[model samples]
Target: YNVTHVPYNGLAPALTGIRDGSVQACMLPYTALVKNLNGKDLRVLAVQSKARLPWLPDVPTTGQQGYPEMDGNDSFVNIAAPKGTPEAVIAKLEGALQKTMQDAGVRKKLEELEVQTMFMGSRETQKWLEDDVRKFSTIIRDAGLSTK
Candidate 1:
C-alpha cells in the first residue's frame, strides 16, 4: 500500500482529519483514542503491542494481523531520573511506582484510558531501551533515514 505520511501539527488536527474523513486511519495512542471510541466513527484495527490489550478484547494484535514486526511498537510511560542519581533514590522511586501501579484506583483509571501499565525495574527498563534502540536503529538504517 502507498501509505501517505500526513504530518499534523498536533493531535487535534490529526483527530479532526480522521473525524471528517480527511484520513482513513491513523496510529494514535490508546489514551488519545479512548474517548473517541464511544461513537461508531472510529475503530481500532489492530494493536501494536505484542499481545492483545485487555481493554480492546475483541481487537487483534498487529502480530496476529500478520505484521509481527510491528509488535514491538508500543507506547510506554517511564520515570527516569538524572544520571548519577543514587541507587537508593532509584529503588525508592521504583518501589513507589510499583505500588502505585498496583493500586486498584490507579489501575482502574489507566485501564479506563486503555493504558495497560506494566512495571519494569531499572535493569529491565534499561534492557528494553537498549533492545528498542537496536530494533528501530536497524529499521532506520534500512530505510536510509540519516540523522544528518
Candidate 2:
C-alpha cells in the first residue's frame, strides 16, 4: 500500500493541520492532543494506551479498537547525572524529588495535566532501564525491526 508522509517539524504544525482539517488523521501522544479533543467536534478513533486515561475515560484504547493487546502508549523518561557527580549532590536531588512527589499541589497539577508520574530513585531507575532495554530488544528482534 502507498502512503503519504507529510512530516511537520513539530506538534504545533501537525495540530494546526488537524484543527483546520488539512489532514484526516495522525497518531499523536495522548496528553499532547487531549486538550484539542475536548469541546471540539472531534472523535478519537482510538487511544494508544493499554487503558483509557482517567481524564479521557470515554476514549477506547487501541486494543479495544480490535488490535488485541496493542500498546501505543509505550514510553518512559529517565533522570541522570554526570558520571562523577558527588554523592551529596545526588542525595540533595533525590530529596527534592521525593519532596515534590509528596507535595499535594504538585501531584494535583500533574494529574490535572493527565501525566502519570513514575518516580524512581537512581538505583531503581537503573534496574528499570536495564529491564526495559532487554525487553525492548527482544520485542524489536521478534518484530524484525532494526536501527541499522
Candidate 3:
C-alpha cells in the first residue's frame, strides 16, 4: 500500500483530522482513542503490542494479524542524569523510583491510564535500549528508512 504520512501537531488534531475525513487513519495511543473504542465511526485495525491490550481485548494485535515484526512496541518513559552524576545518587534515585512503581496508588493510576509499567534499573534499561537499536537498525535499513 502506498500510504501518505499526515502530520499533526498532536493527538487532538490527529483525531480531528480522522474525524473530519482529512485523513483516513492514525496511530494514536489507547488513551487518545479509548472514548471512541465502542463508537461506530472509529475502527481500530490492530494494536502494536505483543499480546492483546487488557483494555482492548477485542482488538487484534499486529502480530496476531501476521505482522509479528511490529510486535512489542511499548512506549517508555526514561529518567536520566548528566554523565558525571555520582553512582550513589543514581542508586538512591533508582531505589526510590522502583518503590514508587510498587505503590498501590501509583500502580492503580498507571493501570487506569492503560499503561503497562515495566520497571528496569539503569543497567537493564541501557542494555534493552542498545539491543533495540541494533535490532531496529537492521529493520530500518532493510525498509530503506534513513537512520541519519
Candidate 4:
C-alpha cells in the first residue's frame, strides 16, 4: 500500500481533520482520543499495545487484531531532575510521587484522563529509561530513521 503522510501541528488539529472528514484515520495516543471516543465522535479499530487499555477495555490490542509486530510502543511518564541533584532530594521526590500515585483521587483523575500510573523508584526508572533507549535505537535503525 502506498501511504501518504500528513503531519498536523498537534493532536487537536489532527483530531479535527478526522472529525471533519479531511483525514480518514490517524494513529494517536489513547489519551488524546479518550474524550472523543467517549463522546462517540470516533471509533477505535485497534490499540497499538500488547494488551487492551483499561480505559478502552473492549478495544482489541494490535496483537489481538493480527498485528503483533505493532506492539511494544507503550509510552511512559517519568520525573527527572538535574544530573547533579542530591540523592536525598531524589528519594524524597520519588517518595512523594509514589504517595501521590497511591491516592484514590489522583488515581481516579488519572484514569479519567486515560493515563496509567506506574510509579518506579530511581533505580528502576533509570533501568527502564536505558532499556527503552536501547529498544528504540534498534527500532529506529531497523526502520531506517536518522536524526539527521
TM-score of each: 0.85, 0.66, 0.83, 0.79
- Candidate 2 stretches with Cα past 4 Å from truth are 1-3, 38-41, 68-80, 83-88, 123-148
- Model 2 gets an lDDT of 0.74
- Runs in model 3 deviating more than 4 A are none
Best candidate (score: lDDT)? 1
lDDT of 1 by residue, 3-80 (tens): 676778888899999999999989888777777884566888998998888778898999998989779688888889
lDDT of each: 0.86, 0.74, 0.85, 0.82
Alpha-carbon runs more than 4 Å astray in model 1? 144-148
Pick the TM-score winner: 1
After the best TM-score superposition of candidate 3, give how far the Cα of residue 66 lies from its true spot, in angstroms: 0.7
> Could you tell me the TM-score of candidate 2?
0.66
Against the hidden true structure, what lDDT does model 1 obtain? 0.86
Task: Report the C-alpha lDDT of model 2 over 44-82, residue by residue, as the tens digit.
Answer: 787776777677788788898786545545455566899
| Backbone clashes, each candidate | 0, 0, 0, 0
lDDT at 109, model 3? 94
Which of the two, 3 or 4, has more lDDT? 3
The positional error of residue 79 in candidate 4, measured at the CA in angstroms, is: 1.7
lDDT of 3 by residue, 5-116 (tens): 6678988899899999999988887767767766665989899888898878898998999989878766678898889899999999999999999999999999987788
User: How far off is residue 109 in model 4, in Å?
Assistant: 2.8
Pitting candidate 1 against candidate 2, the one with the higher lDDT is: 1
